[model samples]
Target chain A: MIFIVLFCFISFPEQRNINELKGTISMIEHERNDIEIMLDNVGMVYDSADGKEVTALTSVTMDIHKGEFISLLGPSGCGKTTLLRIIADLIHPTSGNVLIGGVSPKDARLKRRYGMVFQSATLYDWRTVIKNIELPLEITHCPKKERHERAMKMLDLVGLSDFADHYPRQLSGGMQQRVGIARALALQPEILLMDEPFSALDEFTREKLHVDLLKIWRKTNKTIIFVTHNIQESVFLSDRICVLSPHPGRLSAIIDVDLPRPRTMDIKDTPEFTALVSKVRNSFEGV
Target chain B: MKKLKKLLTSKFFITIVWVVMLIAVWELFAFHVENIKRTPENVQPHLSGIVDSLTSDRKINGSQTALQMVIENAKATLTRAGIGYIIGIASGFLLALFMSLSKIVEKTSFPYLMLIQLIPILGMAPIINAITGDIAKSRIIIAAILTFYPVATNTLAGFKSVQREKHELMYSYAANKFQIYTKTMIPACIPYFFTGLKISAPMAITASILVDTLQGGIGLGCLLSQSLKGAMTRYVFWDIVFFSAVIGILSFYIMGIIEIMMCPYRRTGKR
Candidate 1:
């Protein structure tokens, strides 16, 4: 009872320091300017085998700006993925509210305004790459002619057009993930909710995908909420990074990236980027 | 052209060689062993004469005709096995789907189904015959019992073993439950279902033959039983030979069709 009350009291932005309260105000104001998504005291608790509640997210409150690249950076068990899922409406939160463009997550999902990419590639084993990419369009009732055209375009954007007819088994892990990204992008939603999309790839592939993802984001100005464990990845790509701490998951800090737009691979090795990585790492180390 | 050339492959050649060699040895031994045998003093004489008649130049009005008899019985046995096998496989797959999709139906019926498979068909054959009053019905009942098991077991397993991540992926796509089953679960289980088909095909035919023997039918088992009952040893000997050849040919073709159907995906790496 004591821990639950403590978690609830500290979860709201008003209970934090003046500087953090200012940061939270600016964040909400920034989101209101573009009107993307709003979460008011959102909390989630999963049903456990023994009838206990496993609190995944505790009173998470924030607003995500339209077309802003946001990264939810947290340590393991910090409920970063759970927060993203709440926004996506994959699992409903136990209490509080989630508003996507002034509607519920399920409403946003039904309107086809949301798209997601998981930690693993999650490509259908039976589908050829082209069919996999076309799946979302088919479900959304896009005509066959437009579906094929749209799928091919997404594949070309991901540089996988040549292998579109090949099955998932024929592709490497990195290639499979590229296909997964293409499939998610095929719907061309306003918001992209990614739960550690590049976490599975090796350092080389991941780094390459980071550069590729930025290029795609620049061309198509969609709001991206990426959940990741890597500090450097969060700082390099995000316009803002929301840091989280565990054990009744609450906000620690939200860092603004004043880094220049159209960030490149070269920016990843710079001193400023290095400093941000260290800062995020220090936050986790403190927790 | 490719298939014809492929028939000369080693498996076909080896099987042909095995059949020819075994038959030649039987012929030679039957003729050479006219002396006393441990089981029956007249056994060798009877066996030798049977082989002699089967291999001998035809007497137009002879007591039996090998080609006509083999073909006729093969046709009858093949028809019964094929129909019963289809009935069993189709219903079994449907039952498995019911078991997987409805928790209430599964809990209430699946334990009893598993129990049904445990009691051998031999124990129930008399009752089955009494109910149907047809030898072929008894044969169908046994084939149905044997054919149903592998389909039920494999299909249940196939539907239950979907990868958790794959299910999540489908759900993420906003796929309804029916779409998820069609898109992932059914396709994933195809290889296992085909494996069941290959195993059950032979079992279905063999069960029918056994059923015929027990129930006294006009099928090849009757010829076998009659030859044995009257001690017409030559007749019994030819009947056994005919039964073996028909079974070998029939089993080969059934499995051949299943293999052809599944050949394109034999190398599909699902993992």
Candidate 2:
């Protein structure tokens, strides 16, 4: 009887491990199949101020996975911003469609699934830091108590809780952009759409924000679509860099970043990081 | 010693010095004019004589002193100007708000505004008096008309100057039109509206004075004209002129204070 009891305890432990492994495998499978955003041959054409038709983007097809950190990398006039805006439903593409979480981009936006950060901080000069973070919640009719709590939480996450009452003008450029990030994250949306959010900052601030952003991604697990003209920045921050070329802007290549996770500023000096950045630069040259 | 040196170099000290020099020059010029042209004290009174006129208890109409009469007339003019200023601000702001709600409205009505502005508003004082036939009513209407143009143009420009990004930010939040106006458009326009107010303030007072002079009413303008026509003492004329200048300066500063109060964000540092 004692032998039987011992054997049952040992076998039960092994059975639980197998079941846990199976659960994780299924979870991984489910996550792989769950495409957060899918763009199908999306194109945009608009009339310029001079009355000429400008084809800003053409035949852009891509799929963004759940919790993926993807960068839309390009130089000026690359329609990278156009693509980001298209996903945010700020501008409707003239051709094809985009499905965000299996719904239309418009529907997704209406459902408040997209949190956007512009190139500038875009913090309303009138509102305090905490109030700026609360703006999204206020629009959504969140309860007053909940809004305050959420804003405080987001401010803490951005490491700027001390500046809760400070105005945008009082903050440095990087700090203002961090407030912008906190404002975006206050809504706890499914995807973060950043349009060169840190491009305006100095290199040191930008590098520091990169690590901080990676830490944030690890914590929140939200899919982020970052747009930038900086090649090294794209290589440093993204799991995948989607290179775009201008002159009737179109997606040229999507390169996978195979660097290790939990990357620091130190990783930026690695040969692998350098090689990937150059490879992206060469992709633009090839275009 | 260092503090004294700093005070000597200060803007306030410089302004005081310039003012004293101008006053001495004026007194010297008046003495020279008296010697050359035999101008009487009433024609070119010295600053001290003006001060005496300012303080004299001599009554005009055997009831009130010249100074008291000037104050009374000023009160009447300022009250009428204040009411007209309020009316102008409300109408101008409402019109601009209505126009901003639609591009069609703005495009259609904006040309009319330009035409109205083109017509010399002061030249219409007689026509306004003819239509109203009441002195007070005509004065008020003229003041309102004069105050309207600056407020309207500045307000419309304010609305237009709201950046595209700000509108987009509101749109991203799915904010309704009312929300957009209250949250973004209105706050952005406050500074600009104050600018209009600063300009219109002096115009409102001037309008009141002009209309008073034209319509034969009890106001500083009436006193000014009466003095100019030699019906009142020459001291009273100079006193009325001084009061009008004071009123203009006072109204402008008052508007500036209200602007600072309303838009605290425009203030750079801690209050």
Least accurate 10 contiguous residues by lDDT in model 2 chain A: A22-31
Q: DockQ for candidate 2, please give it.
A: 0.18
Best by lDDT: 2
Q: By how many angstroms RMSD does model 1 differ from the true structure?
A: 8.5
Q: How many pairs of residues collide in model 2?
A: 0
The Cα error of candidate 2 at residue B148, in Å, is 1.5
lDDT of 1 by residue, B1-271 (tens): 8886787676978799888897788656655664435534235444445555556555322654654454466577767877888888898888888888898978897778877678777777778888888778767767877778788778888888787767755665677778777777777777667666767787887666666668554565555565556634444446455566567567757666765565443445554
lDDT of each: 0.77, 0.86
Best by TM-score: 2
> Whole-model lDDT, candidate 1?
0.77
**What TM-score would candidate 2 get against the native?**
0.90
**Best-performing candidate as measured by DockQ:** 1
